[model samples]
Target: MALFHVRMDVHIPHDLDPEVRAQTVAREKAYSQELQRSGKWRELWRIVGQYSNISIFDVESADELHEILQGLPLFPYMDMQVMALTRHPSRID
Candidate 1:
């Protein structure tokens, strides 16, 4: 398996009329575990934001990353920008 950095910019409903956010959060957490069990998830994080959240993660590949990013249970409620990534060099040991 190879290592790949995955970054996504995700947008969701802000009003929270019916808690689309809550449901999605639950599903996403479950999905994160699923990916981990599948030996595909390396790391993941969500950044705080006003209307949109940016996420960063490392996975096995672009294809695997895409399938995982689909966010199965809540895919319809949001939009995202996914991209493969590279890490910069470290300053020192």
Candidate 2:
């Protein structure tokens, strides 16, 4: 499996309808949970004072990671960066 570091910043428009925002958040959370259960999403850390997050993912390939990310409910409103990871030569895993 390959490891990836993904950083995401949410950019939902301020004038968006409240009901739609609520539904979007709900779906996003549910989808995130689904990824967690599937073992593809490994860890998530919320950035303080911002609508952003840093996540670690374990997947087979970059294509699979892209597929999983595009499946997110908030993909349209998110600015994301994905970096492929490699084990450090000095580290044991």
Candidate 3:
């Protein structure tokens, strides 16, 4: 498995319908939880004072991560930054 760090910032248009926003957000939550339960999504943290989150994912490949991100309900409204992670030699666990 490969590890990745992903930062996602969400931007929902002010003109979007409230009902649609609600449903999309709900779906995004459920999907995120599902991924967590499956162990693909390893960690999640919210950015203070922002509609953004930083998460870690363990997946088969970058393509798999790409597919997973694209499957998010709010994909179109998100700006994401992703980086691959590797253990530091000096770190002891």
Candidate 4:
């Protein structure tokens, strides 16, 4: 499996309907948990002072990661950056 580093910034419009926002957030959390359970999502960290997150994911390929990320309920409201990862040569697992 390949590893990817993903950074996401959420941008919920101020005028979005409250009920819709709540539902979307709920679905997003649920989907995230599903990914976690499947071992595709390795780690997630919320960025301080911002509605942003940095995550590490283990997937077969970039296409697989793209499929997982695009499946998020909040994808429409997120600005995301994805980087493929490789282990450092000096690091021994």
Candidate 5:
């Protein structure tokens, strides 16, 4: 499996309908939790004072990661940065 670090910043429009925003956020939560339970999403940490979070994912390939990200309910309202991870030779478990 490949490992990745991802940071997501959300920016839902202020003018968006309240009901729609609530529904979308709810869906996002469910979807993210599902991924976490499945072990594809490894870790999640909130960035203090921001509507953003850093996450780790373990997946088969970059393409799979891309697909999982694009499937997020809040995909259209988020800015994301993704980095691939590799173990260092000098590191010991």
Candidate 6:
């Protein structure tokens, strides 16, 4: 299967307090579970890049990936960029 690169442009709505950040952390984990139930969001690397978190998308195709993104709880609040990728020689190790 082909993979797509998903970079989320996040601007959190609430203040970045310890409590709120904690909630965000839990929500992020719950989001993974919600996505997992759909059988489309395969587990992949979530990178802590300087700007955004990058996740590799492994869905049917770009269109399907869009649908998957739309279904995500965080999608409504943030911007997204997705790029299709070929196999990389390195990474995922």
Query: How do the predictions measure up, each by TM-score?
Result: 0.55, 0.96, 0.98, 0.97, 0.98, 0.60
TM-score: which is higher, 4 or 6?
4
Kindly list the per-residue Cα lDDT of model 4 for residues 11-66, writing each as its tens digit.
Answer: 99999999999999999999999999999999999999999999999999999999
Residue 13 displacement (Å), model 4: 0.5
Once superposed on the true structure, which residue ranges of model 3 sit more than 4 Å away at CA? none
Instruction: Give the lDDT of residue 74 in candidate 3.
Output: 98
> 21 in model 2: Cα distance from truth in Å?
0.5
Off by over 4 Å in 5: none
lDDT of the candidates, in the order given:
0.62, 0.96, 0.99, 0.96, 0.98, 0.69
lDDT of 1: 0.62
Clash pairs, candidate 3, are none
Give me candidate 4's TM-score against the actual structure.
Answer: 0.97
Worst 10 residues of 1 by lDDT: 49-58
Q: What stretches of model 2 exceed 4 Å from their correct place?
A: none
Q: Candidates sorted by lDDT, descending order? A: 3, 5, 4, 2, 6, 1
Q: Which scores higher on lDDT, 4 or 6? A: 4
Residues 8-91, candidate 1, lDDT per residue (tens digit)? Answer: 444556776567678777877798787777667756566665444445455666776667667556566656666566545974
8-63 in candidate 2: lDDT tens per residue? 99999999999999999999999999999999999999999999999999999999
Residue pairs clashing in model 5 are none
* Separate clash counts for every candidate: 0, 0, 0, 0, 0, 0
Model 6 lDDT, full chain set: 0.69
Model 1: how far residue 70 lies from native, Å: 1.8
